[model samples]
Structures are given as structure tokens and as C-alpha cells.
Target chain A: DAGVTQSPTHLIKTRGQQVTLRCSPKSGHDTVSWYQQALGQGPQFIFQYYEEEERQRGNFPDRFSGHQFPNYSSELNVNALLLGDSALYLCASSQTGTGLYNEQFFGPGTRLTVL
Target chain B: DQQVKQNSPSLSVQEGRISILNCDYTNSMFDYFLWYKKYPAEGPTFLISISSIKDKNEDGRFTVFLNKSAKHLSLHIVPSQPGDSAVYFCAASGAWGTDSWGKLQFGAGTQVVVTP
Candidate 1:
């Protein structure tokens, strides 16, 4: 079975522009979460989506938002991106109460580069 | 602020030796811990984990030891092989039933290099 998948392996945009990244969770999974990994740093939590509603969010600004579709796919949208927004966007999925300690499977991630 | 931290940015070890990576967290509410290994151009891969109740958890050559009182955990890879060369990340989550439990706080990661 295919694992979590993300679209647009890489993206480059200018400041004040908007960008949309897509993610498809692993089969049989329902929850989707997003993370941002900056250079030389670990992945930081962005937010999570469950039951088609946002379940939790991190310290990120309002410019970051996400949506979970009925099919368990997700999209992360960053409005008026800044150069600091350049980072690797990772998508993770977990089936509540199905895996070990809610182990999450992750996609390769979309590399976002803001110019 | 980063709740989880790996003080060591990188480590080098000889093959067939023991490798230990340390992680510390500032949040006491975290009960579940996990270690993930990542290679170039890939997402973090689950390695092993330990719950708060258990002080130790092992899988093959990989083992994790948790010290709740000290708020520290370490991942040990015995007889490390060349394939173990990669970046290892330590992550923690809040207790179940908490709103932030679904999101994991991760450390900056420790890069391990096994030299033959």
C-alpha cells in the first residue's frame, strides 16, 4: 500500500505571494498534521486536522492555515509568504487509536522557497 | 521556544561500537516519547519509543531509556553499523486526552556517522 504522499516536490515564490501545498495521508488513516522544518532545525508542529476540522495548532502566525478533506487528504496554505516561510513542509498522518502510541507516518515533504 | 532539545548536533562513531544520543525536554506533561531517523531527501522514519511508565524499551540493537524525574531520554544503538549513519530526532507528545497530544514536539536532531 502507498504511504503518505505530498504534491509539488519543490516550490519557489516571491514575497507577498501565496502558496498552496497538498498532502494525501496514508491509506486507512484519517488524521493529518503539518510541520515546518527550517535549515539545521527539527520539524516544528504547524497544526493538525481531524474530522474535517482543525484539532490543534502551534505557535505559527495566522498566515498559516490548513484543511482536511473528507478523503483524508490535506492542504496547507500560507498567505503573503515571507522569506522566513522558506522551509520543508512535511505532512504526517495517523489513525487515532490504531497505531502504536498514535505513531504518525510522514511524507517526503514539499520544499518551499520564498524569494 | 523549543520544548525538546538535542544538545549534540552531530556524533561520529566507529562501526560495531555503541552510539548514544541524548534528548531533554522541558515539558512535564509529555508522557509519550519517540525517536525517528531520517536520511537525505526523506521524511523522518519511526525508530522506537517509550511511554512514561516504562523506563526502558528495546528493539534489536536500538534501545531507549527514559528518566522521567530528570526529564531526559537517550537512544542507544549497539554495535552500530554503517547503515545507522543518519540524523536521529527525539520527539515527545503530551498526555492523552490533551488538546496538544496529537502534535509532537521535536528536537533539532543529532546526526550520527558510523565509520568503518
Candidate 2:
């Protein structure tokens, strides 16, 4: 089975500009989560989506938003991007939302560069 | 504030030897711990996990030991190979119920290099 997949392997945007990143969940998975990994740091949770609604979000500001489609694909939109927004955006998928034991499968990630 | 911390930024070990990476957390509420390995330009892959109920968990050549009292956990790799060299991240989550929502908090990560 195919694992999680993300689109726009890399991107470049200027300050104040917006960018949209996409992700396809792994086969047989329904929950999708987005993370931002800054250089020399581990991935930080952005938000999580389940059943087409956002379930949990991290400390990120309102500039960062996400959507989950009926097909279980997800889109992460960053408005008014800042220089700090330049990082690797990773998408992870899990089989269930309620189980604490479920392991998440990650995608290759989309690298975003803000100028 | 960094809830999870990997004090060692990097480590080098000779092939066929044992490699141990350590992690500490300040959040006592974190009960589930996990280790993830990542190569350059790739997302982290799950290595092993241990629940608060158990002090240790082993799978193949990898093992994770959790010391809840000390808020510390470690990943041990035996007979390390060059391919085992990668960045490792420690993650923790509270119980699924309540306000936790199963969110995972991650450490900065440690780079491990196994040389022949």
C-alpha cells in the first residue's frame, strides 16, 4: 500500500505572500496531521484533521490554517508568510484518531522557502 | 519551552558496537513515548515505542527504556551498522482521553553516526 504523499516538493514565496501545500493520506488511514520542521530542529505539530474537521491545533498563529477533504486529502495554507515560515512542512497520517497507540506514517514533506 | 529535550546534538559510534541516545522530558503527564529515525530530506520513521505502564520495550535490534520517575527515556541500538546513522527524535504524548487529544510533543533530535 502507498504511504502518505505530499505535493509541491518545494516552494518559494515572499513575505506577506500565501502558499498552499497538499497531502494525501496513507491507504486505509483517515486522520491527517501537519507539522513544521525548522532547520536543525524536530517536527512541530501544526494541526490535525479528522472527519473533515480540525480536531487539534498547536501554538501556531491564525495565519496557519488547514482543510481536510472528503477523500481524506489535506491542504495547509499559510497566509502572510514570514521568513520564519521557511521550513519543511510534513504531513503524517494515522489509522485512527482516538487510539493513543496508533503510529503515524509520514510523507516526504514539502519544503517551503519564504523570502 | 521545550518539553522534550535531547541534550546530545550528535554522537558517533563504531560499527558492531552499541549506540545509546538519551532524551529527557519535563512534562510528567506524558505517558506514551516514541522514537523516530529520519534521513536527510525525509520525514521521520517510527522506530520503537513504550507506554508508561512498561519500563522497557524491544523490537529486533532496537530497544527503548523508559524511566518515568526520572522523566528520562533512551533508545539503544545493538550491532550498529552504517545504515543506522540518522537523526533520531524523541516524542511523547499524554493519555488519549481528557484534554490531551493525543498530541505528540517532540524533541530537537540527535544525529547518530555509525562508522565502519
Candidate 3:
């Protein structure tokens, strides 16, 4: 089975610009979550989408938003991007309520470089 | 505040030796923990996970130990191999019934270098 897949392996945008990264969850998965990994830091939770609605969100600004399609695919949109927005955007998918932890399967991630 | 912290930024070990990676969390609500390994140009892959109910969980050469009282967790790789050389991360989340729904909070990550 194909694992989670993300679009635009890499992206480069200027400040105040907008960017949209796409992600397709793993086969048979229902939930989609987004994370940001900075240099020397672990992946931080951005938000999670279930049933086409955001269930939980992390300490992120309103500039960041996302949507989950009926096919379980997701898109992360960053408006008015800042230099600090440059980081690896990772997309992970998992089934909701699959016991505890709900191990997430991640995609290769989209590297966003804001210059 | 970083709820999960991996103090060790990197670890070096000889092949066929034991490698222990530690992680500590301040959030008592976190009950489920997981370890992930990542290679350059790739995303973190789930290695193993443990719930609050279990103190220890093992799979093949990798084992994870959880200490709820101390709010600490560890991942042990026995007889480490060169291929295991990668960045390892510790993550945790609250159960489903609670407000947290698989929203994992991760550590700074520990890079493991297995030298032959």
C-alpha cells in the first residue's frame, strides 16, 4: 500500500507571499495532521483535521490554515508568510480512535523556503 | 514551553552495542508516547509506542520504557547497527476521549550515530 504522499517536494516564496502545500493520507486512513519541523527541533503540531473539521490546533497564528477533502487528502495554506515560516512541512495521517497514541504515518514532507 | 524534551542532541555508539535515548515530559496529561526515526530527506517514521498503562514495550531489537511517575520515557536499541544511524524523536499525546486527539508533541530529537 502506498504511504502518505505530499506535493511540491520543495517550495520557495518571498515574504508576505502565500503558499499552499498538499498532502494525501495513507490508504485507508481518515485523519490528517500537519506539523512543522525547524532546524534542530522536532516536529511541532500545527493542527489536525477530522471529519473535514479541525479538531485541535497548536500554538500557531491565524496565518496558517488547512482543509481536508472527502478523499482524506489535505492542504495546508500559509498566508502572509514570514521568514520564520521557512521549515519542513510534514503531513501525517492516522485512523481516529485506533487505541491510544494513534501512530501517525508521515509523508516525505514539503520543504518550504521563505526568502 | 516544550512539553517533551530530549536533552541529548546527539548520541554516538559502536556497532553491536546498546543505545539508550531518553525523553522527559512535563505534561501529566500525556499518556501515550512514541518514538520515531528519521533519515535525511525523509519524514519521521513511527518506530514504537507505549501507553500509560504499560511500563515497557519491546519489538525486536528496539524497546521502549515508560516511567509515568517520573514523566520520563526511553528508547533502547540493542546491538545497534550502522543503518540505525539517524535522528530519533520522542513524541506524546493525550488519549482520544480527552480534548487531545492524536496531536503529538515532539522533542528536539536525538541524532544517533552508530559507528562500526
Candidate 4:
């Protein structure tokens, strides 16, 4: 079976511009989460979507938002992007029934480069 | 403050030897711990994990040991191969507060290189 998949392997944007990244969770999975990994740091949690509603969010600014469709696919939208927004956007999928013990499958990730 | 920390930035080991990567966390609420291996330009791949109730979990060549009293966890790889070279990240998930159970806190990661 195919694992989690993300669209637009890479993206380039200018300051004050907007960007949208897409992710399709692994088959049989229902929860989707997003993370941002900088140049030399580990990924920082952005937010998580479950039941088509945002369940939890990290400390990121309001400029970062996300949506989860009924099919369990997700989209991450960053508005008024800044230079610091440049990073690898990773999408991870898990099953809600497993709760905290579920192993999340991650996609190849979309590399966002803000110019 | 970093709730999860991987003090070692890199580690090198010979082929057929054992490689041990360490991780420490300060959050007692973090009951579930996981290790993820990431190659350059790719997302992390789940390796192994241990729950708070269990002190150890093993899967194939990977073994994870958890010390709840010390709030430390480690991933041990036996007979390391060159393909094992990558960045290993320690992640934890739990209901620390009102937060969702799916949220995870990750460490900076440790790079491991296995030489032939």
C-alpha cells in the first residue's frame, strides 16, 4: 500500500506572498499533522487535524493554518510568508485509535524556500 | 527550554559493532517515546519506540531502552551497517496537559555513521 504522500516537492516564494502545501495521509489513517524543520534543527510541530477540525496547534503564529478534507488529505497554508518561513514542511499521518502509541508515517515533505 | 535533548551531535561506529544513541527528557508526562531515522532531504522514518509502562522494546536490529526514573531513553543498533548512517531523532508524545495526544516533542537529533 502507498504511504503518506505530499505534493509540490519544492516551492519558492517571496516575502509577503502565500504558499499552499498538500499532503495525503497513508491509507487507513485518519489523523494528519504538520511539522517544520529548519536547516539544522529538528522539526517543530505546527498543528494537527482530526475529524476535519483542528485539534491542536503549536506556538506558531496565526499566519500558519491547515485544513483536512473528508478523505483524510490535508493542506497547509502559510500567509504573509517571511524569510524565516523557509524550511522543510513534513506531513505525518497516524490512526486516532492508537492514540499516543501510534507510529506516524511521514511523507517526503515539501521544501519551502522563501526568497 | 528544550524538553527533549540529544546531547551528542554525532557518533561513529565500526561495522558489526553496536551503536548506542541517547536521549533525555524532562517532561514526566511524556510516557511514550520514539526514535526516527532521517536521511538528507527526506522525512524521518520511524525506528522503534517504548512506552512508559515498559522499560524496553525490541524490533529486529533496533532496541529501545527506557529509564523512567532518569527520564532517559536510548536506541541500540547491533551489527551496524553503512546504510544506518543518518540523523536519529528522539520524539515523545502524551497528554502533557490539555493538549492533543498526537502532538510530539522532538530533540535536535544525533547523526550516526557506521564505517566499514
Candidate 5:
């Protein structure tokens, strides 16, 4: 089976521009979560979506938002992007009821470069 | 604040030997810990994990040891292979059934290089 997939392997945008990145969860998974991995650092949680509603979020600004469609695909949108917004955006998927012990499968990640 | 910390930025190990990667955390609330391996340009792949209630868990050539009292954990790879050379990340989460919902707190990753 195909694992998690993300769109736009790479992106480039200037400050104040809006960018949207997409992700498709692994087959048989119902939850989608987003994370940001800065260079030389581990990924930090951005937010998670279940049942098309945002269930939990991390310490991110309001400019960062996301949406989960009926098919469990997700889109992360960053508005008024800043130079620091550049990072590797990763999308992970897991079953809704698997809880914390279950493994989270990740996508290849989209490289966002803000100029 | 970084609740989880991986002090070593990089480690080199000879192939066919044991490779140990350590992680420490300050958050006592964290009850579940995990390790992930990532290659350049790719997202992290789940390696192994251990719960707070358990002291150790092993899978094939990989094993994880957790010390609850010290809030520390370690990943041991036996017969380390060249393909095992990658960035290893340590992550933790609060107890299940809480609002955490798999939102993991990760440490600065440690890069492992295995040479033949």
C-alpha cells in the first residue's frame, strides 16, 4: 500500500504571500497531523485534525491554519508568511483510536523556502 | 522550553557493533516515548517505542530502554548496518486519554553514522 503522500515537493514564496500545502493520509487512516521541522531540529507539532475538525493544536500563530476533507486529505495554509516560516513541512497519519502508542506514518515532507 | 533533549548532535559507530543513542526528558507527565529515524529530504520513519510502565522493549535487532525515575531513554541497535546511518529523533507524549492526542514533543535529533 502507498504510504502518506504530500504535494509540491518544494515551494518558494516571498514574505506576505500565502501558501497552501496538501497531504493525503495513508490508506485506512482517519487522522491527519501536521508538523514543522526546522533545519537541524526535530519536528514540532503544528496541529491535528479528526472528523474534519481540529482536535488539538500546538504553539503556533493564528496565521497558520489547516483543513481536513472528507477523504482524510489535509491542507496546511500559512498566511502572511515570514522568513522564519521556511522549513520542512511533514504530514503524519494514524488511526483515530490507536492512541499514543500507535505508530504514525509520515510523508516525504514539503520543503518550504520563503524569500 | 525543550522538554526532551538529545545531547549528542552526532555519533559514529563501526558496523557489526552496538550503537546506542540516548535521550533525556524533563517532563514527568510524558508517559509514552518513541524513536524515529529520518534520512535527508524524507520525513521521519517510526523506529521503536516504549511506555512509561515498561522498562524495556525489543524488536529484532533494535531495543529501547526507559528509566522512569531518571526520565531518560536509550535506543540500542545490534550489528549496526550502513543503512542504519540516519538522523534519529526522540519524541514523547502525555498519557493516553488526555488532550495530548499524539501531539509529540521531540528532542533535537542525533545523527548516527555507521561505517564498515
Candidate 6:
């Protein structure tokens, strides 16, 4: 079965611009979460979506938002992008919302470059 | 503040030797910990995990040890191979209840190189 898939392997956006990155969860998975990984650093959780609603969010500002469709696919939107927004955006899927024992399957990730 | 810290930015080990990666967290409420391995241009893959109730969990050649009192966890890889060289990250989360649903706090990551 196919694992998680993300669209537009890479993206380039200018300051004050907005961009949307897409993700298709792994087969048989329902929950989707987004993370940002800067060069040489570990990923930082952005937010998580379940049942089409954001269940939990990290310390990110309001400029970051996301949505989960009925099919369990997800989209991460970042508005007013700044140079610091340039990073690898990763999408992970889990079988359940419990988040404790559930192991997350990650996509290759979309590299976002804010110019 | 960085709740999770991996002080060693990188490490090198000879092939067939033992490789131990360490991680420390300041959050006492973190009840679940995980270790992930990542290659360049790829998202991290889950390696192993241990719950707070348990001190150690092992799977094949990979093992995870948790010290709740010291707020530290470690990943041990035996007989390290060149293929095992990659960046390792330590992640932790609060209880798995409804409110905290899998929110993970990650460390800076430690790069491991297995020299043949």
C-alpha cells in the first residue's frame, strides 16, 4: 500500500505571499499532522487535524493553518510568508487519534522556500 | 525554550561497534518518548518508542531506554553498520488523552556516522 504522499515536492514563494501544501495520508489512516524542519534541525509540530477540525496546535503563530478533508487528506496553509518560513514541511499520518502508542508514517515532505 | 535536548550534535562509530545516542527532556509531564531516524531529503522514520510505565523497550537490534526520574531517554544500536548512519531525533509527548492528542516535542537531532 502507498504511504503518505505530499504534493509539489518543492515550492518557492515571495514575502507577503501565501502558499498551500497538500498531503494524502497513508492507507487506512485517519489523523494528519504537519511539522516544519529547518536545515540541520529536527521537525517541530505545527498542528494536527482530525474529523476536519484542528485538535491541537503547537506554539506557531496564527499565520499557520491547516484543514483535513473527509478523505483524510490535509492541506497546510501559511500566510504572509517570511524568510524564516523557508523549511521542509512534513506530513505524518497515524492510524488513530490517541497519539500515545500510534506510530506516525511520514511523507517525503514539501520543501518551502520563502524568497 | 527547547524542552527536549540532544547535546551531542554528531557522533562517529566504527562498524560492528555499539552506538548509543542520548536525549534529555525537561518536561516532567511527558509520558511517551520516541526515537526517529532520518536521511537527507526524507522525513523521519520511527525507530522505537518507550512509554513512561516501562524502563526499556527493544525491537530487534534497536532498543530504547527511558529514565523517568532523570528525564532522559536513549537509543542503542548494536553492530552499527554504514547503512545505519543518519540523523536521529528524540521526541516526547504528554499523556495520550483527548486534550494532548499526539503533540510531539522534538530535539535538535544527533547525526550518527558509522565508519566502515
Candidate 2 matches the true fold with a TM-score of 0.97
Q: Per-residue CA lDDT of candidate 3, range B1-116, in tens?
A: 99999999999999999999999999999979999999999999999999999999999999999999999999999989999999999999987677665889999999999999
Q: Which candidate number would show the highest DockQ if scored against the true structure? A: 3
Q: For candidate 3, what is the lDDT?
A: 0.94
Q: Can you tell me the CAPRI class of model 2? A: medium
Return the TM-score for chain B, candidate 5: 0.97
DockQ of 3: 0.82
Model 5 Cα lDDT, one tens digit per residue, A1-115: 9899999999999999999999999999999999999998999999999999998899999999999999999999999999999999999998977555646889999999999
Stretches off by above 4 angstroms in model 4 are B95-100
The TM-score that candidate 3 achieves is 0.98
lDDT per residue, candidate 1, A1-115, as tens digits?
Answer: 9999999999999999999999999999999999999989999999999999998999999999989899989999999999999999999999987644667888999999999
TM-score of 4: 0.97
- Which tens-of-lDDT digit does each residue in B3-39 have in candidate 1? 9999999999999999999999999999899999999
Question: TM-score for all predictions?
Answer: 0.98, 0.97, 0.98, 0.97, 0.98, 0.97
Docking class of 1: medium
Clashing pairs in 6: none
**Models ranked on lDDT:** 3, 1, 5, 4, 2, 6
| Alpha carbon lDDT at A58, candidate 1 | 94
Clashing pairs in 4: none
Number of backbone-clashing residue pairs for each candidate, in the order shown:
0, 0, 0, 0, 0, 0
lDDT for each residue of candidate 3 in A21-101, tens digit (9 for 90 to 100): 999999989999999999889999999999999988999999999999999899999999999999999999999766555
Query: Candidate 6 clash total?
Result: 0
Runs with alpha carbons beyond 4 Å of true place in candidate 3: none
The 10 consecutive residues of candidate 4 chain B with the worst lDDT sum are: B94-103
> Between candidates 1 and 6, which one is better according to DockQ?
6
